[model samples]
Target: MEQKFKRNIGWLQGSAMTIGAVLGSGVLVLPSLAANMAGPVSLISWGLMGVLTIPLVIVLAKLSTLYPSAGGIAAYARQAFGERAGRITGCLFLGTVPFGAPICALIGAYYLGHFFLLDAGGVTIIALGMLIIAVLANYRGIRFSGNVQALVVIGIAAALLASIIAAWPMVRKESFYPFAPNGWVPVGTVMTVLFWAFVGWEMICHLAEEFEHAKRDIKRSLCISLVVVNLLYLGLAYVTIGTGVYLEQENLTSLTGLLESGWGRLAGSIVALLGVAACYATIHTYMAGFSRLVYSEARAGNFPKWFGRLHVTYGTPYRVLIVLGPFSMMVLLTGLLLQLDMSILIQFPGSIFIALYIIAMAAGIKLLPPKSISYYCAWLACIVCIIIYLFSGWIGVYPPLLAGASWLFSRQRIRVKNGAISG
Candidate 1:
């Protein structure tokens, strides 16, 4: 018999995991990227994206409360749209792992390189090492990952707080002068990019079944995490922009540059290490969530039965981890070897995530009672998702293509199986 996951998580751990996942590479890099696109006005984009996510979060929270499942968003899709939609949602969410996890690892690797003065070869080696550690930590079980995530979130929060304090004195009012030099149009463009930072909230839904009190605790955790994440993100953007570091050099390690400008190299190095910790937290949570998604699909017969197997003692989805870890590493290696722009890798997953969000919100509208607050929120969220998708440009095209392809392939497989059974 397959062992079941233990519901060992409480509100604190759940909130920590959500916040940790949200605070990852985005906080470390997106502000600089957004600034390069929109100047100080990008700070408004940060705040705007944060506010826009509230409706989406509310809808997801309601869905999780009503129908908690290991499959999370995929389960919601199944309830609302039946088996095919569910399978496609599962595939899209799972597809994110190949591109998304490597992006997180690369973010950490870039920072590690800055901190250690390592070359490309050294960064690749360190990134691969971090990926291994994340895989092992997740294989141990959710409880173990939850604990590590709690500590990591604390470290990241503290580091950001320190960076804010250190940079407080250097903040100048003049930084706001040429704020919209690129005008409001770029703000919309940058909002699409900043939306990447807000993707983690929905990922936490996959762990809803693992929470001790899924109904009350998941809601509380997401609410608390939302507040914390918004404050930290806005604060980080304020300091990064005020210090004018992003304007000077729009590199991946711009947060470190911001800190170094205010304090020195030592402070910059400490923050870089914290960025590495943030990456681990995000990767750990995503691995845990993605593995459960695979386990849920397997159990539903969407994937091979082997993927549903659990570790006898740990109750973790060991098979999924075994398969996914190496696959992600291969993708990471390909990106590194080919010297692909990290932005392409990052933006690719963001598109899929937005598509997933649209589906989840649509599911909420279908599942929840009509005219209820949850239903209304779902409607608003769907609109916001559509707007973001439009702003996402050509990158947005990939998710629909991926989904259509998966749907067609799945339908063909079903036809073949049905024919075999009839014969």
Candidate 2:
């Protein structure tokens, strides 16, 4: 008998759910950051990121088309190379969970704090609690998780569209006159941050095992999600930045600020409520994906069986969720106790994931067979990614080096002859 995995996910369910996972509070915040760095001309950075991101997305699409296994990039790399390479990919993949998931929880909590007047410690406590609830919801079953994701994602997209529509007429034409006030450095920095925004395309590939029709649906879902994400991002930028709202107010850190300038206090608060809901949805999305990563690692023997086993009735990795909840709670408490901004602490870990993404794009492309278009696009993608990587300000991520060293020390080293990591 063939071993079946999570089988309820269809194209609509998968695409909408995947988009929910990818889009986050970044949408609420990144526009101002981009505009601040490059003025209205920062829209150019959107084009640049789309250029870089599309090729990588294509490579991932090709890989998922070829191999729709739950292992995701780790499975693809392992088939091309060997166990050693696979382990490295898996480790790097797992590493992002620690930072990314907790960051989402803390960020969502912060926004909720804006309304409740929660202190930093109180917000952290609430964030940790939210993380736990999100994880538990997943542990209940994939059906509940998928349904909840679909609802929240639909709400998120609708809320974002409503915000843009409400604010469109208020755009100041003169605000866009002095574009590029800063320079390209901030352009690169903001792009680096936005890089995280386009990240979850490959994550859906990991659910290749879960989707009912893995091969065709996986590729379709990924491409569809990519197009949808790009469209939303571009639309929001025009509504918020093209109108000169960013220039006048100089803040995109919250929908509250954007809405107030574009609309009135009543409308801004309404949008903020939507933003908070979107953030919570994002928080759950983070836990769902990160829990799966834990399940992936545990099955690989890198972690204990406790992490691998699913809940008997729900068929979800309950243990992994349990463990992750407390750890993220600690992150919340520590962030509160030390009075640290979640973004500051998150930047380091987030950079490492971005590095993994660049490497995944490069490696994914390099591993393809000749006579295929993806092979050529992969190398081109790699070169572009390397350029982005240099400008990405992630040279000292610390984790990749330590990770690379650990891989080198434990077994055979990947000989980087002529700048390629190979055996």
Candidate 3:
């Protein structure tokens, strides 16, 4: 018999897990990105994004109650539509994980090195070191690593809340004077950038197989998680705008420049450190849940059956961990070596991910038989997403569409046997 992962993570651990993954470097750099893209109206767009995401969260949570499994969105999609549709959802969901994990790792490393005032390539080396440790810990299994995750979540949240509050007095009210200075084009562009800030909320339900009493807890956890996250997000946005409007109406570039101006040469370094920590936490959690999903896929025969194999002592997928670690390191090096702007590189992928999510949620709600009419709210969610995507512009929207399309094509190969889609 195949060994079962102990269903040990509960509501609190589960919530921490999800929030930790989503809340990462997003909070740190958002102020800068919002400044660059939306001016002040990104707040409005944010509210829209929050409202739209709620329904999909509800659907995922509801599914957790009825069909709690590691396949997550994949399983939800399968049940609602059919085997091929479900497989498409699964492939899309899993495809992004490997790509994202490594990049996030390298990004966090860049920050780590910066915090220590390290020289060129210092960030890359530190990031790789941290990532290796993280990979080893994850391969050791959740039971051993749960406490560390909990601490990272708590520490990161506390620091962010404190930073936002601490920066409150710096607001200049007039900063938002020329809201949308570049006009609607940038606002839409930033909306796509901000979408990355909100991407990982569904990871909890995807890891549902590990939860205890998943039905009741999943609902409680998602609600609590989103509320906390939203508040933090809004608080940061307010600080950025209010502070900017106070500091003579400059755009994000100037505003960020101002963040360090009062302090001189060492200016903004503190915030920079915070940004790196946030990235580390976010990247760490994303990889953990992502690896779990991959391991689960292997078990279900959706991946190379070999991927399902586990380490003898830790009961983790040692091979997958080994493969993914170096991949993220490579991306990190490419980004830093090229001196790519963080905002441009990171924002585009986020926009693409959001587009993919809109489809996944649509597939889940439409394909599944509705338990209630309110469940139809998912279509509203999709409409909201489309608006955000359009506002974000064609550049931001097309990549994820192509990615999800690729995943859809991969499903065509799965053999249909006895009314079941078999990989």
Candidate 4:
């Protein structure tokens, strides 16, 4: 008999995993980046995205309750549309993991490098090590990784709180006068960048089947995580602008400077360590979700059947996790060698995620009962994703390109199957 995934996630662990997946290295840098772009008025962009995230989260949470599967949004696409749509959804989401994971790792490593004053090479080495650690944690099984993630979520929350409290006294009334210095246009522009931070709610949908009470716990966890994540984001954005840190230094090290300004130099080091924890937590959850996705796709015959195997002892997708380690190493090394711009790196995968959301929300519209709250929310979410993708610029071409690739891949697999049957 084939081993099945264990139901090891409870409401609290589910909430932590959800939080860890959404609130990552982006929190450490994005507030400051947005501030740099649109000045203090960037807070409007943050608030707008926070509001938009509501229906997106609700639609996804509802979908999880309705069709709890390891295939996640892809499964929903298959159920609502057909096999071709499922393959495209799966491929698009899988594309995000490879690029998104390394970006998170490097951003965390940038925080550490800022603390230790390390060069690019040292930072690349640290990023690689973080990926390996995240992979190993997932290799152990969901129970083990989920527990580690819960603890890391606590640390991440504490770090954000500390940074906000320490920087509260630094707020200047003068900072509010020239809020929209770059005009209101950049507020919308920065939303394109902020989209990356909000793309993670779907990650939890992929693991909904693992929850002890899929319907009850998934709903509870989604509510809990959304509250926690939005509060942290708003507080951090307020401080990043109020303290005028964006004007001083606007990069991954921006959070470090905010802490050092009020708490002391030691606080900078502490935030750096916790930043690494946050990044690992994000990577760890994605690794779990993506590996299961691959496993599910394989079982459906969209991939090589060998990837469908689970670990005999842990009942985890050990084969997929094994492949992730080397794949992550190669991507990180290539990025470092090429000296790629961070903006390009972030925007590419970020656009792919926007594309994935558009399709998933469309799936929700087709599957959910018409005129229900979830169905309405799905419509709103679909419109929101379309708006975001419009802002994706030229990088938006990736989704169409990826869709084409998935079609060709499915066709070739069908041809091979027919040939073997004839033989």
Candidate with top lDDT is 4
The whole-model lDDT of each prediction reads: 0.86, 0.69, 0.66, 0.87
Cα lDDT tens digits, model 2, 1-423, are 222356777887678767877787788777776776677777877877877777777787788767776567777767777777667777775556656677777777666676668787777676777677777777777778878778878887887777777777776777677667776566776776677677666667666667778677877877787887888787778776766656566353445655675566665456555655656666676566666766776787655657777666777777877877777767666666777766666666565655666666666766788757777777777776566566545545565785776588445433444346443
CA RMSD (A), model 3: 4.3
How well does candidate 2 match the true structure in TM-score terms? 0.88
User: What are the runs in model 2 whose C-alpha is more than 4 Å off?
Assistant: 1-4, 179-189, 250-254, 261-263, 392-395, 412-423
Residues 345-415 of candidate 1: C-alpha lDDT, one tens digit per residue: 78888788889999999999899999998899999989989988887888888998899999998999999
What lDDT is reached at residue 197 by model 1? 82
Displacement of residue 323 (Cα, Å) in model 2 is 1.5
Question: How high is each candidate's TM-score?
Answer: 0.95, 0.88, 0.82, 0.95
Better by TM-score, candidate 4 or 3 = 4
Scored against the true structure, residue 13 in model 1 reaches a CA lDDT of 85
How much is 223 displaced in model 2, in angstroms?
2.3
Which residue pairs of candidate 4 clash?
none
Quick one: ranking by lDDT, best first?
A: 4, 1, 2, 3
Model 2 Cα RMSD, Å?
A: 5.0
Error of 3 at 210 (Å): 0.4
The TM-score between candidate 1 and the true structure equals 0.95
TM-score of 3: 0.82
